[model samples]
Target: MKSLKITIALLLTAMLLACAGNDELDGLTADSGEQQMYDQAQRYLRNRNFSLAVRGLQLLESRYPFGRYAEQAQLELIYAHYGAYEHEAAVEAADRFIRLHPQHPSVDYAYYMKGLAAYAGNTDLFARFLPTDVSSRDTTHAREAFAEFSQLVSRFPGSPYAADAKARMVYLRNLLARHEITVANYYFRRGAYLAAANRGRYVVENFQRTPAVADGLAVMAQGYIMLGMNDLARDATDILALNFPDYPALDDDGNLSSDYSLEEGQQRSWLNRATFGLFDPPEIPQFDTREQYE
Candidate 1:
């Protein structure tokens, strides 16, 4: 009996609001109605009906742009867009909220979501885990994601999202570092010795702690050797052997022994197989070697 009364009351309220909406889009945006609509949207959000939640929030914002719940509705709208996989819209909404309420206590949440949107906005979700060299790929979104996360961490160390933001930043930095190494390797393959060497040097200079540093050192040494810069080659070789003792670039005597050549580095390429394109490649390369990057 109580449930029936509540249902009838809600129906009447909706009918009243609809009539009020006809008079002015926000004519029903009184305090009581605003709370009711916002509460209904919260229910939709809790039910994971993000589309419905989005509609409710949109109505809340449009009807009472300056309502007490307007800011909170905008925040919820961002989440609704994100939950629905509307990544670009989520980011745009986040940006708008941040701009409008720079001093709002919840601004850090907006920043965090901005980074999350970019991180998850890659062309394919699987691409994030693919073995293809990132240097040959478009990493603009990744870089932007990193920047957003970085800002949140740096500006709000105590933010609830700070720890996760730091971890993500580390991953992005490593990814960017590896990209340089891959590009260097590709240049070496294309017989652009100078470009390859320069790329290796960039990684060494910019990305020290990453695993790519070992490869960078090897590429640099090989590039110098091929370019007839024996002294520089020797320096790179020595440093690599010293730091990464088990590195494949080193020989039994802990000396640079292998001639790093593009022809030498061709192992199974994910890009080549992806030509198989998820269904099956026309030909899959034999053997998956972990150390194939050498």
Candidate 2:
């Protein structure tokens, strides 16, 4: 019964979508050729009427898939979806265009658009309006965008979009590395030294050129020290000193500062736990590895 109800709901949703699509096409009647439809979609796009543009472009593709405007219409649909904030749809449209026209002259644009869509997907309305810490949030879309941009750069190094893609890739890499550091910091604060060390090690291994590597090494060293692994801690500090001598955690004498010492029996106050550690927080050893976003 539940399955049948779900199926019914899906059918109703499809019907509503069909009706909405038709409504979006309002006075724009289909002409004899795809050119007219494509033109109308372009007009809608120019006016930022993304809903109308998406419907008109989709209609053009369906009515005249082999027409001269068919490929261009498909490409335009991707932009229309992106403009409408339909990021997943935009990515799918871009992917379809790339798969169908791999050798086409404008295929690089499809790749660029795919990366752009995924990049935009990572930023939600809250992040746009509020001072949210994006690095502390889920990084699924960031990783996806990084991979997409990487593919674009690898395949079309000379393309016009390659430079911008490279810039965004750098940002994403830093964001990803910072996210790992944030997790490591959380684990360290919560007394999970081994887990924190592992997270820091992951950042050092995977994100070499990112600014977060210094912080990662700091975390690994402090976390290992907390776990009584002095040898491992020394190794981490040595590497940090070699690669990033200016690391904030290092003392003037080139040794790990005594500030990050772990207090074995430090307990959180009731007020601290009640406020989620915002007020009257525990005196845990923390490294300020939050590198400013590049």
Give the top-scoring candidate (lDDT).
2
RMSD of model 2, in Å?
8.0
**Highest TM-score model number:** 2
- Give residue 277's lDDT in candidate 1 (0 to 100): 27
Model 1, total clashes: 1
lDDT of 1 by residue, 1-294 (tens): 686687678768966764554353223343437788888789878977676677789888887899899999999898888886788999999999999999999999999999998877765643533355455577788899999998999889999999999999988888887778777766654455678789889989998887778888887887786677889988998898898887765787876664442232242245534543233222211111126432
- State the lDDT of candidate 2 residue by residue for 1-294, as single tens digits: 686687678768956775676475656555646667877888889988787789888889888989899899989899999988889999999999999999999999998899899988877753654578888889998888989999989999999999999999988998999899888878765666789899999999999988888888888898888788989998999998998887777898778876775543454566766665466655666665555423
Per-residue error at 145 for model 2, in Å? 1.2
Task: Give lDDT per model, in order.
Answer: 0.75, 0.82
TM-score, cand. 2 vs. native: 0.83
TM-scores, all candidates, are: 0.73, 0.83
> How close to the true structure is residue 241 of candidate 1, measured as C-alpha lDDT?
84
